[model samples]
Target: MHGLFRFLALSAALMLGFSALASAEPRVRVETTLGSFVIELNPQRAPLTVASFLEYVKAGHYTNTVFHRVIGNFVVQGGGYDTSYVEKPTRSGIPNESGNGLSNRRGTVGLARTGEAHSGTAQFYVNLVDNAALDPQPSRWGYTVFGQVVEGMNVVDDIGAVATGNVGPFDRDAPLQPIIIKRVEVLQ
Candidate 1:
């Protein structure tokens, strides 16, 4: 009878310990001067994007990056520079995994890209609305969207609502007042 009681107690202790450890895992949080936004990464579809982004997160690459572009009713982009407009050196490009069937819907996060495959570095964008046109197509390349803004869409909205102007010879739309990404955390 004493042995049984001892076994039960040990089992209970182990379960509780595991639960505590799981709960204590650090969740990634991106706190901008504008507001705080949280994201839960998806490693399934956009593995490369997830790996690279998480690598940067672990290394604190996004600590002082700025949201270089903002287009109200469209998208807000960041993870490229500081308030001084100094660009950070990014990791090697990841393959265009936009073939993963995810759409660039509102609140969704996608890697920024140029016209070439494997061109996405650290730059990313948060969808302002359902930008379905950015979705993957069989005939053409698309941006890889590996996660969504699980929390703090209000912060994203706030950034999107900021007034934009051209900077550093950028003729279209950039933030006149550089909005900085103060920090990014990976939530457990």
Candidate 2:
């Protein structure tokens, strides 16, 4: 009987420890030409996506990148293009984590991918509105929402308001004046 009680206690303790670690969300401060904003990444909800984003953050992959796509009332995307509009190489795509329970709400950050279901690479976007249409449905995969802006959402709004026009091959939605991502840093 004593051994059984001891085993139960050990199991309970282990579970609590694991739960605490899982709930500890990672955060990053994204510094851009518009302003700086902090994002709290929910690893509990999107583990693989969070890990991949952090890998890029730590490696300085976002520095000097420009928000290549910006649509008012829609999204501001970056993390893969430089000031000269050159696409930066990234690690292979990650599996879609759209079913992680996060939504495409305003201020939420999502991975940018091609039409393929699981093609998220280095690019990401911040939703400017409650974009429910981008949420996952039974028949299709949606963009994965891995984080949300915890501070300076006004900065995101400011970026969304920038004038956009044709820039080379991108004949629409590119910011007329570049919104550069000066740097990105991981926060404790």
Q: In candidate 1, which residue ranges exceed 4 Å CA deviation?
A: 1-27
lDDT minimum window of 10 residues, candidate 2: 18-27
Q: For residues 92-124, could you state the per-residue lDDT of candidate 2 as single tens digits?
A: 999999998899999999999999989998899
Q: Can you give the TM-score per candidate against the true fold?
A: 0.85, 0.88
Task: Summarize candidate 1's per-residue lDDT along 1-188 as a digit string, tens digits.
Answer: 99999999999999999998765423368889998998766776777888888888888889888898899999999997767777789877888888887889999899998888779988889999999888877687878888888889999999999988878645657888878898888765
Residue 35, model 1: lDDT of 85
Clash count, one per candidate = 8, 0
Candidate 2 accuracy as lDDT? 0.94
